[model samples]
Target: MTGPSPETASRPACWRPARADDLPAISAVLTDPAFFDVLGAVTPEALAEACAPDGARRLLAFDIDGSLAAFAYLSGCDGDRPKLEEFAVLTRGRGTGTRALSALLEVLRAEGRASFWLHVVPDNSRALALYRRLGFGREEVLPDFWQTRNGDRVDLLRLHYDFVPAGV
Candidate 1:
């Protein structure tokens, strides 16, 4: 049930490469009840695999002190800009979300990734807002894109984010 302290001010922060050892701590934040309510349950083993050394994808973030205040996952990039598959924050009403997204964008930009794509559960209003604020837009809505816990499929909103500067 441990969570990040409330954010009192909005400030700039940077991100760095994440290691396999960070997986357990990162998984703890991701598996929190508050987060599970939206993304559903995910196993730590899955996270570890995603963060494995040989994986083409990567997970990165900015931690406040020793706590993972924010986190994100980039995948499917290969030779292109990787898509941000997931982003999360441990606190609400704070700028942690924005900072995290910004950091992730910077990393993608540095890697020459001009654009990426992802999908969101249409019902997650908060996540929708966050993605929009981070410059993601709805590209399409896939009906029955994701199966739910109750054996019912729900729609998903496909979103795209372009980080390339104008005329680039």
Candidate 2:
């Protein structure tokens, strides 16, 4: 990993909109063995789309001491529904994903988002617990929701976080 582990690094105050230059490290993390199931395919083309001023796909990165440590991948924010496709840490167990993801969530809230959704592999118990602890409600099981690069079907647990509850 290019950056310090979560426990050793100073906690970042916030996340920033991902820039073109962040692509390399962001690519490295997403493609790393620890997170590839989400997507090892966050290509340059995709990064371009994410960095575009009006594109739907958005990338938010949190760095420590100028190196990439974590990033959140989101899409369709301008519409009624936004999906948090990935909120990944460069390493698997440094334990900073919660902090980074919390900061990233604020970025979305600042944009006037009322709610957003994410999906995680059912088997990733740690991630599931983390999201739940952060107040994401488990919505349902989306069976065979995705097909991996290896042509394997993966079922995901859909989760939702509402900044403003519906009945409020």
Candidate 3:
């Protein structure tokens, strides 16, 4: 799907690798109320660890204003594909998630990754729709996949996408 265009309505966010100096901004974005509601509790240390690219890690997203927009991290899976462990954006209704996702696909393409997969709470309709728009398809749904911060268990929907180069 085509990404948000650079227009007056909303400037598309800039994409880059996570920097050591961006830890504070990234932490705030990840631990925001919106994030907590969807992703449950997130610790600062965990965010820092993910930001540090030791292996097949993530590339962080920053907005045009230089604010931390989102992050996408992956780890080795059973085969050549990588499992998208975490992907979250700070703001909504501005296509920040779309921008971040497009950037992620580019990075994966650069690395020649065959596929990327992730799991999300089934009830997160916004995220589900976004993933669908980005070419991800539901592989399975696991019951009682995780517990929320409020101690409520929830189901998880696993999604996968096989990347195909243009003109292939």
Candidate 4:
């Protein structure tokens, strides 16, 4: 759905940078079967390094009712164009991802970025629908872009969103 359900729409959004200690919780949410297929067998140590407090990347989390609801990882953050590396939402079909992503786009806009980009598996129509609804456009296809833990290579469709500052 493009819009969050009314109940979820009113819920508060708690987006914060993920600390080193948050890796376990983050790893749990991501390794669940709901997400494990796409994420593969990610380890906590790997998460710690990827989500390190260093300025090179931005790993943000979204919480609801004091519980982890979503996680977003951005790379190439030291540059003008940050790449949205990963987006995982524990709560789906509740408009959680949409709202969470909208919040992230605003953050990028506030950062004065001209644009941000992400890659999604072509088969993830649900995510593709959401991306398109949120103003992302297809850029190109990167063949064999993702290598899963099972030795399977996956192609990804690159999508990008250009920032539109408030009031145009």
Output the number of the lDDT-best candidate. 4
lDDT of 1 by residue, 1-168 (tens): 865445623333656556676777677776665554356444666566566433666667577655567667767757565666667776767888877777677767787776877878878898888889888874798987787554567888889887765487
Which segments of model 1 are wrong by more than 4 Å?
1-12, 32-37, 40-43, 52-54, 165-168
RMSD of each: 4.9, 4.0, 5.8, 5.5
Q: Least accurate stretch of 10 residues (summed lDDT) in model 4?
A: 34-43
Superposed Cα RMSD, model 4: 5.5
> Which pairs of residues clash in candidate 3, taking residues 3 or more apart in a chain or in different chains?
none
Error of 1 at 106 (Å): 1.5
TM-score of 2: 0.83
Candidate 3, residues 1-168, lDDT tens digits: the string is: 765455622755566667777777666665666555466555666556556555554545555555677766566723558887767776668898887887777777787778888888878899899999999984698999888665778888899888864357
After aligning candidate 2 to the native by TM-score, how far in Å is the CA of 130 from where it should be?
A: 1.2
Model 3: how far residue 137 lies from native, Å: 1.0
lDDT of each: 0.69, 0.77, 0.71, 0.78
- Point out the worst 10-residue segment of candidate 2 by lDDT: 33-42
Tens-digit lDDT track of model 4 for 10-79: 7778778887767777777766766644664545665666665457777788877556788887788888
Q: How close to the true structure is residue 112 of candidate 1, measured as C-alpha lDDT?
A: 78
User: Once superposed on the true structure, which residue ranges of model 3 sit more than 4 Å away at CA?
Assistant: 1-14, 40-42, 77-79, 164-168
Q: Which stretch of 10 consecutive residues in model 3 shows the poorest summed lDDT?
A: 52-61
- Can you write out model 2's per-residue Cα lDDT over 1-168, one digit (the tens) per residue? 386666656755457778888888777776676555655366768876887645688887787656677888888867756898777787667767887878766766787888889988887788888999889994799999887655678998899999888888
Which pairs of residues have clashing backbones in candidate 1? Answer: none
Model 3: lDDT of residue 27: 68
